[model samples]
Target chain A: EAGVAQSPRYKIIEKRQSVAFWCNPISGHATLYWYQQILGQGPKLLIQFQNNGVVDDSQLPKDRFSAERLKGVDSTLKIQPAKLEDSAVYLCASTLRSGRVYNEQFFGPGTRLTVL
Target chain B: AQSVTQLDSQVPVFEEAPVELRCNYSSSVSVYLFWYVQYPNQGLQLLLKYLSGSTLVESINGFEAEFNKSQTSFHLRKPSVHISDTAEYFCAVSTANAGGTSYGKLTFGQGTILTVHP
Candidate 1:
């Protein structure tokens, strides 16, 4: 099966600018996740969706970051007025179930964002 | 609340040498453990996971991790690694249960970069 897909493999922007990243998870997968990975660090979960409903968004910066999974499928993440610290890779992943024991997550190639 | 810690930020080793990457996790509830590998310019791929039963799990590519409940550690190890094994590895934890409560949201550790040279 094809893996999770993402667009805009790389992006460069200035601080205070806005940028968006898109993700298309594996067909039929019900759970989707967005993560931010800074240089030399592990990916941090930003948001999670089960179908079209948000399951978690505690780590998301409500001031400048937003994400949506429409129709329970494809999703997008936006960082508005980006900060210098916003420079990182945005990753998307999908899983067959929201349960921890059911299935493993499949990930996309990720969008690398650089802010000046 | 949950958190994961990887003590080593970078580990360099020669081919055919043994290596270990240490990981510790803190969680109030029962949690599932996982190891993920990220290749250059790519996203993370699941290396292995520990849910229940055995405290040991092995990945296809000659990697194994032992889950030590007492130590609260899940350390990845390889007896002899190849150059292709070079990559960044992450350890993550999430509640064992699913649905509205846990959402299976993963909390990841600071990654460990393993560089294998010839």
Candidate 2:
């Protein structure tokens, strides 16, 4: 079975510019997530979606980051006015369960964003 | 809210030697623990997890973790490590929200970099 897929494995942008990353989760998976991993740090969840609805996004920086899972199969995460601190890897994950429970999360290769 | 702490940021060990990576978590209620491995330039992958029952969990690669509820700790260990075992290991905790939904919002530790030299 194919795993989660993400676009633009690497990206580079200048400060104040905008960047977007795309994710296509595994087939039949109902839950999707976006996470940010800074250099030398672990991955942190930025948002989660169960199908077309959001499940949690409390940790996300609302002012600069946004994500959406329109059809619930694919999702996109965007950052506007990117800052040097925004340089990190954007990981996308998915799971089989769509319920209010937890399951094994499958991750993608991730998009490495470098903001200069 | 839950939080994870990896006691060591880096650990260097020789091949065929045993190594342990310590982890601790803070949470009021019961929680699920996980260990994820990230190789250079790769996304994170589930090494193992502990939900209930047996406190010990093992991965296919000879890695194992023991969940200690009272101590609020889950440490990963491996005997006779190999050079290929080098990677960043992340400890994570999952807890239900106010609405009691385990939405997969993992609280991860900073991470432990394990380097094995032959």
Could you tell me the fnat of model 2? Answer: 0.86
| TM-score of the second chain, cand. 2 | 0.93
- For model 1, residues B20-107, the per-residue Cα lDDT tens digits are 9999998455778899998876678999998778999999999999989888999999999999999999998877543324447788
B66: Cα error in model 1, Å: 0.9
TM-score of chain A of 2: 0.95
Residue range A35-76, candidate 2, lDDT tens digits: 999988888999989898998999899999999988878999
What is the lDDT, from 0 to 100, of the residue B105 in candidate 1?
A: 78
Estimate the TM-score for candidate 2. Answer: 0.95
Q: Candidate 1, DockQ to 2 decimals?
A: 0.58
Return the interface RMSD of the candidates, in order shown, one decimal each.
3.1, 1.7
- Candidate 1, A102: how far from true, in Å? 4.6
Candidate 2 Cα errors over 4 Å, as ranges: A98-100, B97-101
Instruction: Please name the candidate that would achieve the greatest DockQ relative to the true structure.
Output: 2
